[model samples]
Target: MDDPVLRFNLRELPVPMVYATHRIIRDCNEEFSELFGYSRSDLVDRSFARLYPKHADFVRTGHMWGAHLPGGKTYYDERIMTASDGHRFWCRVHGRTRHPTDPFAQAIYCFQALTRPVVLGKIRLTDRQRQIATLVAQGKTSAQIAEEIAISVRTVESHRARLMKAARLTNAAELVAWFSTQNSS
Candidate 1:
């Protein structure tokens, strides 16, 4: 017996989905519009940078993913993103490219809102701070994190200090522990 064919519709998936080419949004589902507070017309042919809370994030995430997706890797991460109303919220993003050899030429992404409040060492962090904190939690030194994000080590240190102070933690170790515990929960 032949296996039955399976069919799936991007629009009917009930998740925020976007198809892009070279970082420009080509098409998106209604759920994507509802999630990001953008109309389909606003997103079509627009750069995906509009959804990022900061330019640094757009750059950093692009650099990070660019290094992987071309190798046929699927990238996943939790991050804070801005909606059309400029309100920031955490989201889990998953993405992959249709052409592994030239990943950014065409890709698909899905976003899931993480409405649960994110507390870094007890203090709420901005999206950038959260990114830095996640790196620190992974045992990356400020210099290493800076290199990875294309930022200076001093800036990474500054963000780390702010994260520590906001969480009311005395040192990196405590901050890492707090972040670890938060993720495990």
Candidate 2:
């Protein structure tokens, strides 16, 4: 990676790549700028939160990184991301940290847009609810979701009930279907 040609190849590899520290973009390749419909000048030295669909999403996702990055795991997730013009797409994101013990101190991430139907878009979910909904959509059981989010199983059920009520659904199966359905314009 220290070789100039190697560096040049990676930067122009046609994958959206970014380098960030403390969740702020330190630099990004040309493909990344294009992917987000932003000039390199516009994105550099800015918080990555601007690219997320909601402030809640930004905050909630950071929690995931905090749990994994310190262990030097290659974090991965498929989530909806937003472009500068407000266009949203599902993308599989992969990230790694150079500073494992202080992951947010330095990290690199890449994005690959997915072809799946958009998720979590039709619902107006709060941060915690959205986190639970994501897990639910991933087919996680109530017990698993509770353990991951450090809440009680009963609390998880409460959220599921609330989500069902909000979506006018009757049960977990319907709740999952409601949350996963594609946008109908």
Candidate 3:
């Protein structure tokens, strides 16, 4: 699979796949271009940041994967990505770097679109709730979230309670797992 010939054949794979070097897209298959609504020409030599729904997501994803990739690890996550037309959808991303010592030098990523209704239930969260969810998914404690968000512990607890009810989850751990899974794919 590390052979250049196999890598070149990624374009023919049925799933959406991309080969990038230093975070810049070097090549992508037709399925990838079609899925993202970008032409091959539009993506080639472009920074992978363009696929993210937000600049913060781009930065956060980089931070989340930076340490693991260079150590010969495969990274997987679920997140919202933007289509060329600016619509967002959840996708499960699988990535591996060819050069473990310098992971960014060459990498391959595969994306699988997830079913939306099963995940979100079309439930929209308030900005504060979303912030809290993000923090929880990042493994922040309630106390840490309270201090960082400048809210009282009681207030944070109350909000969390409401979120759990809304999501129909039973506990903090469940809520965190839910948030993490939702954000992941």
Q: Write the residue-wise lDDT of candidate 2 on 116-163 in tens digits.
A: 676445657666776787788778899988877779999998988887
- Model 3 agreement with the true structure over 1-185: per-residue lDDT tens digits: 58565454877799999998988999999999998998999999999899986676787677656756886679776667889997778778889998959877888999998764224434576656766776676577889778766788788788888989988999878987677545322
lDDT comparing candidate 1 with the true structure = 0.79
Cα lDDT listed for each candidate: 0.79, 0.80, 0.78
lDDT of 3: 0.78
Model 2 has how many clashing residue pairs?
A: 0
What does candidate 1's lDDT look like per residue over 1-185, in tens digits? 99999887777878899899999999899999999888889999999899887887887788877876885678776666788998777788899988868888989999999755543333556767767887786678999788777789999999888777767889888987776545211
What is the TM-score (0 to 1) of candidate 1? 0.73
Model 2 root-mean-square deviation: 4.1
lDDT of 3 at 176: 70
**Relative to the unseen true structure, what is the C-alpha lDDT of residue 9 in candidate 3, on a scale of 0 to 100?**
85
Q: What is the lDDT of residue 143 in candidate 3?
A: 93
As for lDDT, the candidate ahead, 2 or 3, is: 2
- The C-alpha stretches of model 1 lying farther than 4 A from their native spots are 118-129, 136-167, 170-185
> What TM-score quantifies how close candidate 2 is to the native fold?
0.79
User: In model 3, where do residues sit more than 4 Å from their true spots?
Assistant: 1-8, 117-169, 172-185
Indicate the worst ten consecutive residues by lDDT in candidate 3.
114-123
